[model samples]
Target: MKKLVLLLIVLVFACKNETKIIEKPIEAVKAKAKPTTKFILETLKSKGFKTFDYVDTKTKDTVIMQQYFIAFLKSGPIRNQNEEESTLLQEQHLAHLGKMYDLGYADISGPFGDDGDIRGITIYNVPTLKMADSLANSDPMVKSGRLQIEVHPWWAAKGFSLR
Candidate 1:
């Protein structure tokens, strides 16, 4: 009985100290653990952006930066079209926007659901406000005096990108 008791204690200690590893392929493990931010950074890098670089700052610290511009579309009071004409103009406007998107002149755009004067917003990849205005003015809606644009520059830290 004493020998049986000793064997049980030895077995318990051996099992408690044992190390178990459920083997998984390294690639599988990595795929499961990969960060979304890493994928976003890689996507941004693929987009021809200088995602990470040091810049001298007034605060005596080098800073990493990324830049973009946003254009705000505001409703205009100059629409002289009836309901049917307005619908046709809207179609033309959408077609013009699709062409710009295909040309990569506009990044992303969407309309607002509010009843305010603000109509829509578009984020542009153009370098200057003049370029942004040119793109905005090229829109059929703007040319027809149905919309106006207000553009602003936006900046962010490196590795932070819209996915």
Candidate 2:
């Protein structure tokens, strides 16, 4: 009976030691893990994105700001396309916008609700105004003179979503 008790105690100690060993590695992994914000900032910087960080006084949280380009699609000189041509050009323009989103070049795009000089807007995620302008001009509507592009640099908080 005494020998059995000794064996059981030894087994318990062995189990405890194994648990401690496992717990140490888990803690080490946690300690080594980087915060998501830091990782994102580093990635953006590495990709040549212009960024700055600030602490929000209200929330006491760090906010990362990134420079993005906003392209305004305006009415161009040529607006006299035939009905079918106009429809086809519109389809091609939408397809171009979709490709931009899929390629991660453009974040969001939408047309205005009412008739206006500014027809729509596309927020480009690219780092440079030149790149954004080029992409915007590549739209079929712009290429065919149905639309014009005016690009400007805009700054916004990174990781923010439209509510």
Candidate 3:
């Protein structure tokens, strides 16, 4: 992977009783380059992904595209459920996610390693954030207060995949 240093600027404007906020990335400044990992490159190649150009709908800028919808599952305010009930809820969560995977709503779902606050993530195949939220809200973990989900929409080139 190439190292890129991006400079971001935030602009705020006030007009009468309204406020507008804008954030823009100015340019990419190259950092120290490192050798590309062969294992990762080989793994990606095995998944049938190829480089392709993608144009941002909002900015109209073109760039290489490889993306997915990432749902960040964070720790919620409620986590006082008993062990027995928590076990059952976990079962339901897995079952619900398994069904979603089988039905093609979710492409990948897993936990982050020992990360605080942020618990896990789900990569959905859906195009819009609304659809991703609908699917995420169906998780038992999210419903039972064990986790809260935040959804992000992502896009990638056609033929992108993982093993």
Best-matching candidate per TM-score: 2
Give the Cα lDDT of each candidate: 0.74, 0.96, 0.71
Candidate 2 overall lDDT versus native = 0.96
Task: Give the alpha carbon lDDT tens digit for every residue of 1-68 in model 2.
Answer: 99999999999999999999999999999999867778889999998899999999999989999999
Top of the candidates by lDDT: 2
Candidates' RMSD to native: 8.8, 3.9, 20.2
The worst-scoring run of ten residues by lDDT in candidate 2 lies at 32-41
Model 3 TM-score on a 0 to 1 scale: 0.58
**Where does candidate 2 stray beyond 4 Å?**
1-34
Which is the winner by TM-score between candidate 1 and candidate 2? 2
> Total backbone clashes of model 3?
0
Residue 153 of model 1, lDDT score: 77
- What lDDT does model 1 reach? 0.74
